[model samples]
Every structure is written in structure tokens, then in C-alpha cells.
Target: MTAAEPNRGLIHFSPRSGWMNDPNGLLHYRGTYHFYFQHAPGSLVWDTMHWGHATSPDLVRWTEQPIALDPAIHPGDLWSGGGVVDLRNTSGLKSGDHDPIVVFSGTQGVRMFYSLDGGFTFTPYDGGRVIAQPSGRESRDPKVVWHEPTGQWAMVVWSDADGNGVDFFVSPDLLQWERTSRYAAGWFFECPDFTPMDLDGETVWVLRDARGSYVVGAFDGRTFTTAWTSPQTITTNPGAAGSDYYAAQSFDNVDRTVTMAWQGGNHGATWTGNASFPVEQELVGTPDGPRVLSRPVDEIRTLRHDTQSWPEATFSAGTHVLGEGCTAELEIAGASRACTLRIRGCFDVPVAPDETLRLLVDRGQLAVFSGLDYRCLNVDLDRRAAGDEIALVTDGPLRVSSLVLHQLRP
Candidate 1:
């Protein structure tokens, strides 16, 4: 079968046949990356949930695989959740040797399945044990991870106890789980992911909020007591610029972490249909704080075509065409404070207000409009102060840097 098209400068990996949400089971096994996601096999609308599978040799180019687990196998229906590879076989299901185990959550309870002959097919362990079912009906979407120090398993599940928060649980042998505590109960904390990262110098817990914000905290295994001092928001969407991106999940790939999310929502134009891209998350030190910036992984460096760099350019309002599928960066100089840089393309025009700016894989025409209502779409800046500024820089294969322009305001 032919592989799916590459995700431009962004690594795209959503279901080619249906709706996708809440990336789950992001694990690296044996030398390949395997991840599961909540999927419905016919539309962009969320209906029934099944585990959509995909594998990547490099974290960027992905090959869509068969459905990992189907909810129809059980009676209740499969919900959104995560998966992990049991390296040591802590469940004690083997006869002569240990095997890799896959643990996930369903509507009934948390379930366990293992692949003895390799990860080709999986069978439930102990007839799919129900690890924990507190209150019995309101718990779903489990995020499980194995704690190295404790040598036990830790899980975070979605609950409605305090208005849609994540409940904590610990299991010694992947069977009996005890409810430990509760974390931030926001409006709707759908997919809760906790990973330890070395930030600056201290180890911090990165928590992704489905509603909007991405929070980092100091976690101590038992509880995430410390609130995130530096709160950052994720604002990029893959399928369409205006579509809603939600339920993002991440996994460690040894050298870097890769993330995926649901592409569209209950409402939107639904242009590209339903799909998503895998983004390599990087911790960049911004003027504001330690922010997470995502881009298509460096493996895509193999796909570069005709790179260009313009050292500098004066700001005169006119249409500037940089070839299709290009990467551009602009550094601003001689600015009183901040200026507005607008990117016009096939997607909605994205305006960035500042000194340093970056745009990736943008196609369509570029134009500078005037007036608050955008009355003049083809106007040029007049007599803009000129200085010895590195206005525009483009390296071959379409990488541009240091382009400066002012935002059109009311």
C-alpha cells in the first residue's frame, strides 16, 4: 500500500477514513513508534470510539496501521484513553518468559491485554481485569505510565467529581488500584497527560488541558501539588487553521517527544475533512517563559526543495510571493516597540505582533491590506523608515528570516 502524503513541514497523522481524537498509547517498542487514538471510522463527527493505530520509523513519516482495539469486542463501547508497553511483564502472565503488555481503559473499567508472539495481536489478560471502578459509572479516559523509581504503575483518569478533573490511582501489579487523590478540576479536563521533563534545571510535570491551556508543575509521584507558574497555550492546528484542535497526547521517543491531537470538532467548515499531524514538541526559551513550540521533526530535512534567503527588504505594501511549500523567518529592526506581521495564504491570515517571527509551509498569495475592515487588500506601506536591518533572510530550500512589516490596525 502507498504511504500517506507527508505532513508538509508539520508531521500529519490522522485517520484517513474517519474521525480522530485524544492520541493514546504513544510508546516506542523494539525500534518503532506505536500510538493509538480514539476514532470513528466514517465521518469527521465523533460517534463511537475505536483505537486507531499508526507506526513511524522516524517520528515524522507515519504509516497508518489497522485498528489496534475495537470497542465492539466488549459490549459497552471503547472510550478515549492511553496505552503502555510492559517491559518487565509486571502482570505475571507468562509461563517461561515475560512479554510486553498493553493496558487501556474502557467504559466498563480499565483493561489489560498482552501480545505473546509479538505485538501483532493482543489477548486480554485474566479476561481483561477491571482494575479500578470508583463510583462505577463516571470514570473514563485513563492515562497510564510506569514509574521507574517506585516500580509500580501510575494512572490518571477523567472524572466528574469536581467538574471534570483527573483522578489519580496506583497499582502494584496492574491489578488492584487505589484512589490516591485528585488534581485540577477544570471545566472539562478530557485527556490528562503527565510526563517528567528537565526544565532549565528542575524536573517539572507537563499537563495538557483539552479546553485550552498547557500547564507545567512540580510533581512528586503521589500528587501534583504545585501549580504551574508559567502557563502556556497551544495555538496551532494541522488540518485547517480555523479548526478546533483538542485532546493532545505525547510520548517519549528517547531523543524527543512527539504529540498528536484531534483535528476538527462538532463545528467548522470541515475543509480537509478529519486528520492530524504528529508534532515534535520542543522546549524553547522565549522572552515570556519556557514555551513549547512544535514543528515537523527534523527527519523532514530530507524533503527540502530549492531553499532561498533574502538578507533584507524595505517594508513597502505589496504582494510578495515566496514559492510553494517554504519555511520563512523574519527578524525585525528599527521598531519603536512592536509591529504586526501578517501571513496571508490558503489558510486564514495569521498575524503575529512582535520583533521575531516564523512561518512554516505556507502557500497561497501574500498581500498587505489596510483599514480596520480590511478595505484595501492590495495597499503598500508608504515611506517606512529604512535602516540597515536584516529585513528578510531566506536560505535555499525556502527558509526565510528577518522579514519586517507592520500590522494593519483599526
Candidate 2:
């Protein structure tokens, strides 16, 4: 049998069939944002990998395209990597005057792929494997970017194959790469991202991984020097570590950095894996030093239909049907003890009295974000509990202000 089709009204993204993981090769080219992912088309479980392709005119609605790269074309499984638009013929693979899109993907070692016809198709580079000898068994997920200051390309690759660390590489023409530096950190696993953003007034770089923990530092095109790092990994889901949200990456070709994560795999369906909602990231200064802060992009509000707003409400112990596939943006002021939100047979969250939570419930799955600290969570509900009703249980009376519930379109 073929893969099961995804449930409509799920705010996030999932392939029509098969398995998907990691947001790879996210590039904005020719006015449309191209999203490539790690997909195993044959089954719902993760096995071999292929670069699954999709396009979005806006970040909300997505359209699937043909799979870009297959294991047959490349020697190894196509793992997690990113892409860039070659303004110049940096890789010398540009088909015509228009800029070519370069994609870096891997399994054992990193290989280069370029799409001369926008991002619809890709061809392996003649140079073959750029990094022939990876340091570790889990050394994959290459995050590459253009270092404009040095007029070169830089890559940060994660490797648990050696230990928990990342290897830094620099390239001049996007074909040949040179190892520049290596860094070992706490819980630095797969899906590495190096982003440069302005903090206060100074420019600081953020080094992050799938772990959700990030390090603040300075990058000089070749070397990255760390200044500070968060003590705890900022989970895409706060309390639920094993939840689907994994291997998230930041987007390029935008004014601000936006990120998306792989939701999870095999939720009793023919298809597996989905993406988390995109979030905008920034570096904020704290007493310790600098910290990375993230919030859902404002554009998602555009998808809000049949919006219901309440200036003030009290939830003692009652079940209220918000809407099907709805996003609940809530602010609870005065505090007391604890409160729990039950949606469908899932969407369960025990929040503090003073906490503000944004809960998105769709497709028998729930994604919760608490405060600006932004520890996120995604949980699947029982198919039997699939409904529009939400029951809020509280120890005492809770006052909510400016609570808005917006129904998401399928």
C-alpha cells in the first residue's frame, strides 16, 4: 500500500506519503522559497534518504514538487544539508547567465549538487565528494553559507562520529573546501547551524544544533570564537525531548532568520514526519551575556480564519470548543498553582499560573510554546479524541487577557 495522506487542517507540513526528516536546503530563489527535506519515499519509516522538494510562495501554504536527489544518483543516502543561490558562477556549474542554486548534502561524506533550472532539479557536481573523510560516523548535516566579508563560503558540519563536536570548513568556489577549525561542545549532535545576527548594535554569530541549545560567538570567515552559550538546550519542545521536532534549520534569502524543524515520525499512519511551524530568531543580551530568542513568525496570523478574541475570561473547570485546527494565543496574568489544557485526546499542557502559552492544535497533534523563552512541545492525540473541544482544568480561578483563537485552514 502507498503512504497515508496527511490530515488536513494541520498547521505544519508533511509529505503526502513516506518518511521525512530535517529541513534541508532551504533557499529563496526566483521569488519563491524552495524547501528541501530528507525523505525516504518507499516507506513510512526512515531507511534510505532522498532530497524531497517543496515550494511556498508564502511561508504558510506549501506545494510539493518532484524529489530532487535519489540514493541511486549519489553513492550514499542523501543526508541533511543546505543550499545557496550562486550569484556569481562560484562553482562554475552555472548553466546560463542566471545564478545557479548550489545544494550541499551527504551521508558518509558531503557531496555537492547544483540546480541550473531554478530549484526543480539538481545534478551532482563533477568534483564528487567534497569532504571525502568525515571525522565521525554521525558526521553529517552540512550547513553552508557565504561569508561575504571574506568573499568565501563557510560550512559548519556536525559529527558525533568522533565525539560531540562540529568541523568547520571554508571554500572559495564552492567546489573545494578546506578544514579551518573544530569545536567540541555540550550535546552538539546533528543539524548544525551558524547564523549571524545583530545584537544590540554589535554583530554576533550563533552556533546551534538540533539540540536547541546555541552558542554565541564571533566568526571571522575562517575561525569561530565562542563568547557564551546557554546552559540548557532550548528544546523545540520544552519537556518532551522525544517529540517529533528535530533537525531544524534557519532560512536564508530573508531579512530576518526564520527556522523550521522536522516534527516526528510514524504516528500510526501510512506517512511519517512533518515540519514545525517556522519561527523568527534573534540574539538578545542578558545579564550572563547574549541569548538566542525565538518566536513564531507573524505571517502565520494571515492563515487565521474564524478568529475569536476574548478580552478576559475565567477557566475554572470547563470544556470549551475553540475550533478545529485552531491556534490559541493566550495570556494568563495573576498566578496561583498549575493549569492543564486538554485538546482532542491530546494537547495536554500543565502550565504555571503566570505563564503565557501559545498552543496550536491540529490533526490530532499539539504544538505548545511558553513565554519568550520558547520551549516548544508537540504531542499526538488519540484518534478517538479528535475534536474541537478543549477542557481547561485549573487548581483555582485563572484570569486570561487578550486570548485569541484563530482557526487554521487546511
Report lDDT per candidate. Answer: 0.53, 0.72
Candidate 2 colliding pairs: 136-161, 137-161, 237-376, 244-263, 244-264
Model 1 gets an lDDT of: 0.53
Candidate 1 lDDT by residue in tens digits, 1-410: 21222221123444566666667777777677776777777665677777777887766566778877776563335677777766666766654453564647665466665566445456766666676764434777787776666778888887777466777788877767888878754544566776666677666667766633567665556676655544456653222322446666777435466666654432222312233345566555666566666654455555444454444434333334433322332323332233334332323233333233333321111212211111101111111212112122222122223443322110
TM-score of 1: 0.73
TM-score, structure 2 vs. true: 0.88
For all predictions, the C-alpha RMSD in Å is 9.0, 3.1
lDDT of 2 by residue, 355-380 (tens): 77777666534556664456544454
- Candidate 1 ranges beyond 4 A from true positions: 1-11, 74-76, 94-99, 135-137, 228-232, 236-243, 252-255, 265-275, 282-295, 313-316, 325-354, 362-410
TM-score of each: 0.73, 0.88
Residue 331 local lDDT, model 2: 35
Candidate 2, which segments miss by more than 4 Å at Cα? 1-9, 131-138, 160-162, 229-231, 236-242, 313-339, 382-386, 391-397
